[model samples]
Target chain A: MRLPRARGPLTERLVACLQRPPRSHVALARTDGRDAADDALALWILHELHYRGFEDVDDAWEWAPSLMSMRHHLERELEERLRAEYSRSEGSRSGQAGGDEDVVAVLHQLIEADDGPSLADHLLRDGTTEQACQLLRQRSVYHLKEADPTAWVVPRVVGRAKAALMEIQYDEYGAGHHDRVHQDLFAHGLAAAGLSADYGHYVDEARLPILEQNNALSLFGLQRRLRGAALGHFAAFEATSSLPSRTLARALRRLGLPDEMAAYYDEHVEADAAHEQVALRDVCAVLVADEPHLREDVLFGAWACLELEARTARDLLDHWAAA
Target chain B: MAVEEPDVRPAGDGPLRCRPCPGGPLLVRGAAQVQGDDGTWHDTTRPVTAVCRCGASALRPWCDGTHKVLSQRGVNPIE
Candidate 1:
């Protein structure tokens, strides 16, 4: 988690500023159309401070006003890009779909309509060991702390939604068993695959799309206004996870890896299948049914999850193909 | 019981020869073993196989791409 190697000017300056005490007026401007690797990783590092600060960077930088302001600017740019990419629908769904009927039906429609290519299939069928390793590295950003993002919504939601979310998160946390927790399982997977299990070990090597995917969850989870979206995001994730996890497990085994090496994916193959029903039914459906207004935001959250995942999949597949 | 070493032979030409599951109608090509319902097992050397990840595949322990459709719809089977 030490400060990653700088990608370009933005990261270089940002990393330098982080090394010292936060400055009040550090220039935060960036030119347009710069290599995404440069900008996105830099932004990711700033965001990472909020999660697990780099090994070399001082912990004080997490709340430093200057660092926060710099991160704010980058986030604004990222948000603008996201807005341009994702158009809000003019449907009757409420901004806060707090009702049951609206949440389940809308979430179902959203899940049904997702037609993206299967990253799991590609991994199961043709993934090389190197590619799988890279995939784990990119995913380490979020998988290392799997359920924390949605946990942000626990207090923001009420009644059934809150209860349902807690129920799902309880399983995500291994129901009080530390070894069974998703994050720990992922770390174990990393170690079994001969990669670093220490958190944030792969920050410097990860691409922009990967960072953006994790950032979306963090963004929605931290903002109270986006609570419905956060629910939608989690719902979409659980719904789509089971088969992919199974495929990934097969892929790992194909590479002569042991069951422990495939433990993370194997665990998800079962866990997410049940989670899908709970998310769509108890969590989303109940929330929307009660609120009745946040349907579109719910769909928006689901779509954003799909869109980001699609981008990540395309990027990883393309990189592997090129290599 | 002690583990026995798998029989290895020189490659012959015929679709890169794979080991068929002894307990079911499944083919696997990799360095792994699949145990069947009758307590029999087969070792495979093929580089790839469609093992069933979902317990419900009509073709038990062999992938028939059923997971593809299920995943696209975001249906969690564990539930």
Candidate 2:
């Protein structure tokens, strides 16, 4: 995919910098920190450098030091913002997980206690086609590359955790069947919906929340220090997916959208049921056992996942309401 | 026509290990085929599969995570 239309000074500079050859001291764009779009888009582009590089950009730019400096700057800001939000969301509860607490139990409690807004519930109840399609576009930012962000944790972990992660990932990657791969299924869904099936097809139209959500996963996955958080976030994601996926499947059928697109959710309804059990019990629990110090980070990561999703839901719902 | 019947379960001594999740479904591994509620053998598809013990699942044999809503056990079903 080509670079998305630049959103601000940062992305504008990034778009231009990619056109040049590998350099040591290219000037990078700076943000005032208040505008999330400028920073989020810049960070998203930088993160993309590590994933599938843009068709137009030189691949050599990925390892350039100057770009790494820029990535670090944006990441620091993003991590700080995420940490603060996690803290604020904790408000009254004894925010920290006890060192000796059962990791799976804590994970279940963390996921169970979450009361965030449900986009699927809304789509199931009274969502219009416009709203549902809007949601599909927003979600494509991540679903198109599902399970990829968490794959980075494989190398960062060892012992049962690593093996357990692969056990879940095997199913996620279609268990050796290319046709069942989650990413391709989502691409098929996009095409069936009459939307673009290309990777990052709607990046240009992605809102601040969507970009930030993508950036958050990239940050956690790319940084070795955040492996616990990465797995935690993944557990939260899988744990919540099964039921909502069923709701979404019914919602899509109700709206008369193509059955092919709804079938993607139908697959998740069953897949995630098995995945959720293994993700929490085998992966996250084992990771915490191997490295007990990461327990809090796991909890924080789960919280961040829910928090970011809630923000995205609010942003889209509010936008739709206003429109 | 007396023909010898062949074994249909997963080959080797790899036992079909199953774990029951608290307030959730029974997770089964290494099963080539499973008997559904109607007593028909359905081919298992994934490396690991969730069998709906709660019986509230729309998917019948496979768990759709409806146990969470049945006994108020796991993630609350509705918003």
Candidate 3:
């Protein structure tokens, strides 16, 4: 949690600013280097302040306006890059209705037609321990605080949708059992695998795509305008999580890790399966049923989830293959 | 050493039998059991039920084809 080593000038300057008292306004001049390099790390650090602040940095810096401004600049650049990289198609727009069709059906089509590169396949079939560890590191950025991003949607939903979210979140929070919380469980997995369980330990090593994935959640969650998107995001995540968790468990077992080490994934295998129904039928369906207007935003949330994840998967797999 | 009670109820069909209730059929494909709000187990006597192998299915104690999707997508753990 100590401030990670500066990857480039952006991080170098940001880190220096963070070490001091919070300022009302500070400007970060744009850098021409690749977005994935130093800018990503710097932006990730800014976002990380909202979670567990860096161990060495002042906690007050979490609310610093100057830091916020700098972070915004980096985020703007990252968003522009992402929009340029992926094009939206009309077929992808099929779920944009506030009509009578079940949102789950639309989600199913999205899942069925997704031809995105398979990170899970590679991990289960042939990933080396080094590569697996790297994947875990990138994921640890979020899994260490699992469910927190989606928690933002709780206040945004009501009645059945709110109740359904609480039911699913209760399990994610381990139902008042600290040891059973999903985030803690993930930490155990990380520790068992010999990786650092401390928050943001690998931020320095994480590339832009990984950072961007987490940033998307924060982006959707923090905005009242994107509440529908947040719900859709959670639905997509829960809907898609079960099989990958099972595969991750198997991959860990294949590598000869103990059952305890695989317990996190094992838990997800049961938890998310049940969650999918609640998410699809009770949560997303009910939310759309009530709001009607958020159908498009919800679908966008789901699509964004898939898009960012695909990019992260491609980035990791491509790097691993090259290595 | 303390021993754990075996919940090995047989899935009754031919030789398969429910462990707890000797005459009761073993729970398997097409059959489901739901734990009610009061924690009572209720048998769902449907002809074809989707079973969850993936832990993510929200209708716990019930299969919903999520595991199949995960497997077909090559995201199943055994892959």
Candidate 4:
């Protein structure tokens, strides 16, 4: 996962600057980015500095004042875009519970009302082997480090929300079995599928929507101000995963993909069922209960999850249809 | 004479908590094992587990979220 190719002036300067040492007073261009993909990839690279960094990059850059300022700018733009996109859709504020309506129930309502293009259903019904392979390639950008982004929410929460979140995270970290860690399991699946299992391997080829989805997770999790949204995003992710995972497993097998790849989704079928329960009833609900003011932020985060995913699904399906 | 409640408290600071989630599975924690539908003792794998209540899961005794699908179709458990 060396620096991906520059998609625009922002990433072009970012990629070049990242290659050299983080010297003081290095001025970056003031452009927002060339296009949506360009902005997404540039922000993605900036976020990558916080994660396991690219080769030959200085660890100190993770907290460099200049880099942090640049990230703050990109993050603000991305956040504004996500909020505007979500609000522009029908009844965006409907996710907010009315007059003591249960937050968890409202989360369910948000999930149920989502009418996004179902990529899993497409794969199960009509996707070709090539489409499945391409999906897997794009998914590698996140699956290789599954569940890590959400871990940042730990210190920011407390009581039952914190405890419940730990329960979910511990299982994701694999319930005391090295062989069961979700990230490693996905790596095995990727290897079995004949794809590169290395972390950030497909980032260079990832579509803009994929980059946006990953960036949203990083943005929500890393910001203490957005902690409510982070948990909201996490809850939506888990609640929506189980049944679709069942569909994806069948789809992968139907496309004649390797069993190990399907096995990864098989694990999610049961795992996400439990994870969703804890996430909604315990994490999100309790967090909102303990602090009642975050109800809107929680809904906003959940909406971001659904809307961004809808965009990604539409992008891929439309691309395939066009081809 | 008291029958002693079988000393069923878990090995931790408290008794096992088995919470029946409305319209979902039974979320249980701090249990060492559970009796499956077939009467075999199944070791609880994680600290928290969801035991199937909808009876529609292919993975018996453990939920795979089949209840949500059932609810969507207006299907309710008879038992």
Candidate 5:
């Protein structure tokens, strides 16, 4: 819950300024835009204020104009970069099929086109204990607060979409049972695996790609204008989760981890299988059906989700390979 | 002497519905239990549950999303 160690000059300046009062005139360092690690860390810190504020930092800083301006600058850069990359890869692809096309089929084709290597497959087949723990540490950054990003969309939607999203979220929130909350289940899994189960425990150790992944979810969720993208990202996530989660659960059991750890994955196997249908058919399909203009943004969000995940997967795999 | 009761309850005035997805599972939106091939009943735990239609699921009576993979790989299990 404390401010994490600074990754670069930007974060250093941001953290130091955060130590002071919100209204105090503290000058922030200019970012060179080349140090992505520093940029991502700074953005992550700013986003964290909206989630759970750091222990010694005043809550008023969450809305401080200077900080808000800096956040906007960083978000613009991130959004531009994501769109550029999307366009680069999207050029050779076919044109956007209209609202009349089956959105669910388009989503499936998008998923199938993702030729990224499977990190889950490696883990399931022959991952070592150290490798398993490394994955858990990195994944803790997002899994600890799972489903919260998409929860932001509930208020932004209406009618069939809202009702369907709530139905899926109800299960994610444990369906009226405290113990069944997905985030708590991951926390329990972490504890059983001998890792620190505290929220934000692994934020300090997170790499740039991991931070960017978290920032992307926050970016899509926090902005009301990006509601279509948020649902798209959520749909892509659920579509990809079930099978990978099954593999992950098998890897956990193979590593001889505690039953609770594996049980978390087991829960996702069936849960996400159903969620995939609801997210794509009921949520995204219905939303686009009502608001035809958002179809492209929805597709962009889905593409961005897979692209960011592929980058993170490759980063982890390359690191493990080099070691 | 004790009276025996049947497992089936009379249909009540509830809005329970079962909708089958093409090439996928049957989505049931209420309190329901699926009797497996082994004769064991599995209770639905979520707000909506996917009852496996493609028999290729690892989790019996519940869809594990294997049908998508199968369909993509040219297996065409549903058809």
Candidate 6:
């Protein structure tokens, strides 16, 4: 995909540097820019280097120390903010388990306690066709490349956890059927709905919350120290996907969207049912059983996943309402 | 038109176990084809497939996570 339009000064400068030949020290203007949409955009662009470098940009820039430092600066802020929010919500270490409780049980408790707004419910009930399409565009940023971030963690673990993580990922990658790859399925859904199926087509249109959601996943997956959080996020993500997918399917049909689009959600209804179990029991539980020390990090990641998703949902819903 | 069955191989030429997940569906592993309630053969496409134990599932023979919804209303299909 071509480079997206720069959102602000940070992305503007970063994009300019990326267009040039790979250099050791392309100085970037310093800014805290915490919670700024531009900050998220710059970080997303930096993370994109590790995934798929832009066509116009030199691939060698992916490892440039100058860009890496900017990425570190932004990630530090995002991680601190996420941890602070997690701590505030947790309020007194009473909710923190000391690796004694079953990790799956703890994950379930967190899932059950999540009283976040449901975007699927809104769409199924009363959301407009325009709103539905808008949400799909925002979601395409990640759905177009689903299950990839977590795949990064596979090499970082061993034993049953390694085997189990692969099992879940195999299904996500379409269980040996290229036609059934989840990302392609989503791309088909987007095309059938008259939206752009090209990867990163919607990044320029995606809101800050959407960008943050994507950034957090990449952060957890890239850091070996955050592998526990990666698996935690994976388990939480799967556990919550199935039923919402059902509602989403119904809403897509209700709004007279294409069957291929609805079918994507339909596929998730069955796939995630199986995935949730393996992710929770086989992957997260087995990993915790082996490491034990990563349990808290697991919980932290799970909470981050749920909280960011909730924020995304609320932001979109509120935007639609006010519009 | 001729139709051929999907190429699938079980881990071994031995019996495979259907491991039940507490509060969820039965997980069958090591390769097999499941016969749906409608008597159609469905190949095990993934490393593990969660066969629906809860009759409320929208997808027969495959769990659609309806069990979690059931559990909310005091139904434990896993039991």
After superposition, which runs of candidate 5 have C-alpha atoms over 4 Å from their true positions?
A: A29-33, A95-100, B1-14
What is candidate 5's lDDT per residue for B12-71, written digit by digit as tens? Answer: 345566777777777777776677767776667788887787777899788898887878
lDDT of 2 by residue, A142-234 (tens): 889888888888899998888778888999899999999998898898899999889998898898888988999999999999998898889
Query: For residues A22-80, could you state the per-residue lDDT of candidate 1 as single tens digits?
Result: 55667766755576678777777877787778778888878877777667776677766
Pairs of residues clashing in candidate 6? none
Query: Which candidate number maximizes lDDT?
Result: 6
- Of candidate 6 chain A, the 10-residue stretch with the lowest lDDT total is A90-99
Docking class of 6: medium
Candidate 4, residues B59-78, lDDT tens digits: the string is 76778888888788878462
Descending-DockQ candidate ranking:
2, 5, 6, 4, 3, 1
lDDT for each residue of candidate 2 in B11-49, tens digit (9 for 90 to 100) = 346677777787777787885565666677777788888
Per-prediction TM-score to the true structure, in the order listed: 0.76, 0.93, 0.79, 0.94, 0.94, 0.94
DockQ for every model comes to: 0.03, 0.73, 0.08, 0.62, 0.70, 0.67
Lowest lDDT block of 10, candidate 3 chain A: A82-91
Q: What DockQ results for candidate 4?
A: 0.62
lDDT of 3 at A165: 88
- Each model's chain A TM-score: 0.90, 0.96, 0.91, 0.97, 0.97, 0.97
The digit string of per-residue lDDT tens for model 5 on A121-152 reads: 98888678899998899999999999988888
Residue-level error in angstroms, candidate 2, position B12: 7.0
Clashes of 1: 26
Off by over 4 Å in 2: A29-34, A91-99, B1-14, B73-79
Tell me which of candidates 3 and 4 scores higher on TM-score: 4
Q: lDDT of each prediction vs. the true structure? A: 0.70, 0.83, 0.70, 0.85, 0.84, 0.86
